[model samples]
Target: MSVYNQPRKRVIQLIILGMVSLIVVRLFFLQVVETKYSKLADANAVLKKVIYPSRGIIYDRKGRSILRNEALYDLMVTPASVKKIDTAYLCEILKIDMEEFRKRIANAIKREGRVRQSVFASLLPPETYGKLQESMYLFQPGFELLLRPVRSYPYGAGANFLGYIGEINPDQLKKEAYSAYQQGDYLGLTGLENTYESTLMGQRGIQYLVKDNLNRPQGPLENGEFDTVAIAGKNLRLALDIELQILGEQMMKGKVGSIVAIDPATGGILAMVSGPTFDPNLLSGSYKALNLGRLLVDTTSPMLNRAIQASYAPGSTFKPVTGLIALDEGVITPSFGYPCHGGYVQCGRFIACTHKNPGHAANLRVAMANSCNSYFMHLYRLSVDNNKWGGTTKGQVKWTEYLGNMGFGHRLGIDIPNEKPGIIPDTARMNRRYTGRWNSCSEVYVGMGQGLLDLTPLQLANAMCIIANRGSYYVPHFVESIDNDKSDLLKKYKEKRDVATHISADAFSQVILGMEDVVTSGTARGAQIEGVAVCGKTGTAENYARVNGVMTKQPNHSLFVGFAPKDNPKIAIAVIVENAGFGATYAVPIASILMEKYLTDTISVKRRPILQRMMETVTMSAPMRAKSKVDSLNSVSYTATAGEELLKKILSN
Candidate 1:
């Protein structure tokens, strides 16, 4: 009886122990190991919301705010949760009709299944949001106001440079580059906004909240354990001086060209301006799409960053480079001179010089100051036809190589996008165009900054910086530094790039002396400024364009390149005004005013009248005006004829 009882007790004990173990394992799986069941259960009651981080603020070099974020509200809709609501009331508040309301709802359903929330209306005005907030409770769980950040420009300038942000397109969503982004995310579309998008667009965060049957958020789910905080974007400090930028824009108001100013010390762009610029604020808020459409069709091409995109003949500005090449090649000394009789007619081709007096070729300094075409023509011939080179092709190749080293015929590696690598006719190009018969004499037009040589305002200005720096240069960039930067954002800009290793510093000084003479007593005498030792070269580029579909010889482009305080130059600048007569007439005054403003922080009282006259002059062509959508762009005055007349009367007095 005792043995039978012991076996029965043991069997019962083993069954009970096995049941306990199974229960323990099941509890552990539900609480720790298996998560799918819990996630499914939580999905109904927990709302997982994304929190977008604020974009980085942009500041000018002086710490003045250029761009910042402003809080705006978006009316979002959850189609699945929608119940019987006041449709007319909602439409009245949003300023839309019932038909528009139905269309938006249909769009939301088509964009995302009924389960997900979609934006119904975005960037609501403060008054609209205020009205909606008062009556939002009636809409229940279907409608909600989501906080969003919209960019605002404090200073209404630099539309082409600051750029604008827009929603990601379907093409972008398909690309691997935007894999991390969702359908409704905004990205930089142009300017600095596009270039620094990664730094400006901060990391998004997630928050999980408990909701009731009505889809109302009750509280944080699981005591906020699954919630993540957003990381704000890094702020950027740009190299632009807002004051100088404004002054440059104002001076370039009546013109259709570009102005680039660089700090020779660090290659930081102090002020870069393309005339006929629109307000940067135009590309912000809910009206961005409409405004963008207007800008895209504007014939003036206000969207074009002419400082780096538009290429033009460097004109006499190329004389300095030719002189540098000749001096570096030992083909000509600073004392080398050539004779000119009204124009150069040695090769049976007449090339006119600016000098009215016919005499011996002036020295390099005098030639540069006077902008003597025959003098540079002779120097180009000597350099390319030198006996040491043996042949014209080889000499032309060597000459072209010098230009290449000086950032011509190639992209200069600027920070922004769409930089043009201006045209420079090399041996290969010349041979292709002329079937290998072209010689130095045939391409002698390049000696005077014409022919196949072209350069953007940025490249032209940078060349002036090279001469100002005496050998080396830093790649021109807008951003000076980033806040809390750890990456190598500014590394490349910090490196010194030497263009011509063989050119002596003395040669640059001699050329600079000639440039100084240009402002003091030569062709660019109008560019003189008090208390500043200005060295400059004036250029009148001959360009042809079609007028009324006929090839017409338009007014020459006015250009000026200079750097002040000759000893240790601080600012180097290039100014180009299209459809303008002479460099000394329009371009010189503009450059002089800008240089004076930068160096002295104000223009002399005596020079104010010249600034006024330059600002009042409008040189845009009739077809250019007819083609432009923005009237103010082609005409300096808001009301073209009236403003012109008023300005004429005021300036004439």
Candidate 2:
């Protein structure tokens, strides 16, 4: 019995010894092996600094800088580290009252706590920064100055195209796509900036620094072993020609409309202007937020990018598509004839023709050249009611296909954002509207480029490119090349896509001849250049809007689409002027000047007067003026562009 008790006592002692050994091992690991917790304990004396990268520069096709960066200073403060300093002197240097300084410090303490840094003053003007820098040493541990980059536009044009950058909102910070970004980061809000943000915003770097007991940064910890080098953003070379852009903007002053010029050979946009534009510099630096707010509420809709966003009836500019569709479907031959008696009188409804002469359509070329409404209406009826298709629905389907091939009823997929897809009447939409009771006669107005056809200026310009290419077109884009062309960023834009099938190249030539006749002796006679053979079509879209709660027809929207040098076709253009009459009046003249400038590098000396008249013209209406006030704000110094006498004439009108 005594021996058994002795063994039990030894076992109990061994158990107690094993517990002591485990506790010793745990203490050793926590104090000697693992260092993370110890580092966390020392974090109170560490400061993490962010090194921001400079955004890329933007250049036009001519290597002129469109967008650039300038250094601005910001004042940062840490509340807990603040000591008894010259508060009154600092406030005087910063142009703030002593009470205001106290309020700011208290607010910063509440927002980020006493241990963190907060922005005391942002984007100080050069004069203020100069004064503050002279006395910065007096503020020591509490205040510091840092450099930040702000955008500056040298060209003073392309506000809508280049876009503006601003601080990221709180909502944007919460998004998963922006998880890498912290508070107070700036990003592009619109235009080319927004479209190429990833490439334009370079990589941000970080530096770890040691801090004193009062939380003042000494120098880099461990000699910047963990620091990353900031990479500058890649530069972008755009397809835009600054001179062309400036000219277009100057031409569009005091008007409410748009002008789009494209290089038909490569699908590159040369110039795009939305009238009522503001200076690009208005959206940079400290005034950005205030100006953007004013613009958001301003009735002129100057912030809107009308070239790619606004949609309107193609009007008579759509007639070529109708003629092409009819010619392709064999419903009409190059010489097919339809007699016109002022208009198409069908199904008991009369649709009047702009050309009121009694003559035969006689041939497709003659019909297109004359813009004969009745002949195209007949072609629409023949195509939609063809016996070969056996029914209106099937034939209408075939017609819609042809429209799609022409790049109508769809977004041109331009690189810019907020592009709208214009409406093309489809079987389903027509069926819903007519309750399955519609016929070709029911939609005959569509055949003449009226009723139910909508297109963006970009789309209208692209359609001309397709015809210029004779059968194929490359997608229109703004940026031609980037710094390192290794990425596939521009691969899709380089491919020439062919959508035209079953239509012969000669078929386009027949239509081209008629379009040439238009500039030579037909309605678009104003579009003729001196040595270049211009081909164009004119369109007057009857606009309707709600006035005093009643839908009323306003003045027509003038429109024109054309290409130059008919044989090689260097440029294709589209112009639209709202509340302006006759495409041949304003749109044709504007487009012709732009074509002449691009092709000849100078306006013909003979056309200088025409150019002067256009620049001095003010076509916006009273209600538009009351809403926008753009003419007073954005118009070229009236005395500079037009003489004081001409300025008075414009103002009086």
Candidate 3:
């Protein structure tokens, strides 16, 4: 057969071509007709997104972060983008009333209309958001689910001190002072948050993006390069020593009062705590709903910064100031003497000094050492009264000017927020109260820290810091350095003047000598150390209780102020145990414990056991049965009307 005319080859080729054609057809059907590239089409239609970077953490002074942040999501909506969503169903899912849903959705529609997302609400429990997510397929273009960071405090701590941050209310937004902030901005409510708002809340950044119907970002509308990077807030380097703060809290446990310890050399606040402290994490941004009133309103007033806010009688701790003033004014010489003969000073009908020591205080030195009411009573009479007791420098007017320099008349301008300027009992106040010329009766008791001399535990401690630093002390502060940069560190407060008491150094030393004697063999024997020279004063001031109008029984406020290594002090402390019977018994020991803790690392084993036992045994001890609560601070029985709400908070805690 001729090759060109071979019908078998021709037939084979035809069959092969036919089969090949069929395979190609099938491939085309599978790739194009059957599959239809559905995955790409779906990808184009449905939107998916995730949260960006997590919020930054907050660090302590030593760079140990105490707070945490994690990613969270919020559901946003535009009313115009609505696709027949059940308004009631949506409102029910979000746990909002119809009115709230209407307001939010209306505002969102007003913001973006149908073309873009309008507004979003947060703090939705996972369940509510999950409900919205299930029906997300039914939602329209302007609906969005976006993620952000929520702050979380590791331990529920620092309620009042590290106050809770919250979303701005309408009232807050209306204020012109806050005009710079948007409605959703976080603000510092109190404590360090309020003080360091600028550094803690960094400058905000912005991002612009295009969204699909579901309000999900399609992509970076202007590319990633155009998105402003968010700068996390610079971490705070608070000067507070966590160990000391916790230890101080423990030491003050069961007591209804406060304690403040400051490094006299640096004026840095080593520890500041109010009794019945609560967890700060309770107020964190991502925190669960809590009973706020139950946390703040308590009979013990745990949230109160008693160290700096609440004022009390300084007791005998204020004796040194008066003694120094008397000496500087030359009211008495080193040889000048006053017989105590039990040291009872009669101020009108009041028998002020219930404490007794035989014989008399010989001079300024002994007067302070003995805490003699008689000596100061005489000195106060000389200082405040020009008409009578004219045995002192110039006149009473000169004395007021001197005390003003001692930080008695005004706030100390401390770095911490909420410090109270303790009442100095100025002539103006006296005039208003008495409506007559100030006399010896009104001014006499302050000399002994008895009456009209309201001071904070912190103020007392600061005053002691001044005495230890010799003449003046920088206003006590917290926050040492940040990012290891000394330059960035807060400047230490310098002494405003040469003296806080404006008394002679010699006279101050003389009074200090008596304080030294106190530790050696005095009311504050419990505060003495084997090697460290402790100088301290104990005061028990009477709080006159009135039934209808007239005063009856006296409830004493126990107080102690002191320093260690008396010649040149290191740490100065003040403690107050409200309603405690004696300052030496309760408050002094606490101060000594804190001072010893600060100065030395390891206390003697014997003393440690004794001190621990003392801490356990003694607290705002009282003879009053109904109010006596040794271990628990919130035991004050709550009754309706006034402070009940506060007591409820403590109980809840």
Scored by TM-score, the top model is 2
Candidate 1's clash total is 2
Runs in model 2 with CA error above 4 Å? 1-43, 85-113, 629-653
| Candidate numbers, best lDDT first, in rank order | 1, 2, 3
The residue ranges of model 3 lying beyond 4 angstroms of the native Cα positions read: 1-63, 66-75, 82-121, 124-158, 212-216, 285-289, 343-350, 355-357, 385-394, 483-497, 500-504, 545-554, 608-653
Off by over 4 Å in 1: 1-43, 547-550, 631-653
Per-candidate TM vs. native? 0.89, 0.90, 0.77
Tell me each candidate's RMSD, in Å, in order: 5.8, 4.5, 16.0
Q: Compared with the true structure, what per-residue lDDT tens digits does model 3 show for residues 182-296?
A: 6456666677666666556655565655556554557764575545665565566555555455556656666677878777877777777677565554444333344345555
Error of 2 at 417 (Å): 1.1
Select the stronger candidate by TM-score from 2 and 3: 2
- Across 1-653, the per-residue lDDT of candidate 2 in tens digits comes to 69879989999999999999989998888778988677655557777677778999999888878888989877888888889878898898788898899999998887566766777888787888898898888887888887778888766778888998877777998899888777667788898888888888898888888998778788998999988988878888988877677777777887888988888888899999998788777777765676677777778789998998888887888887788778877777788878787877875888877666655477777777788888888888889898889899999888888888777788777887888888787898788889999999878878877777778898889989888778788889889999985899888888888989568877788778878887887789999888899999998888999989999999999999999989889899999998889998899999998898888877776787887888888888877677774544444311222223333342233
Candidate 3 to truth, TM: 0.77
TM-score of 1: 0.89
Model 3 lDDT on a 0 to 1 scale: 0.65
**Tens digits of lDDT, candidate 1, 1-653:** 68879989999999999999999999999988999778756766778777888999989888987788989888989787888988889999999999999999999989865656788998887899999999998776788888888888766666777888888988999999998788677888888888999999999888998888877789998899989998888898988887677767767775799999999899998889998777776677766676668877887878898999999999998898899889988988989888886788877888888786744356888788778899898888889998898898899988999888888889987777788999998988898889978878888889999988889999999999999989878999889899998999789988889887788988888888888988898889988889889999999999987879998987899999999879899899999999887999888998888888778877787898998887778877777767776644323211223223433443343
The worst-scoring run of ten residues by lDDT in candidate 2 lies at 637-646
Candidate 3 or 1, higher TM-score: 1
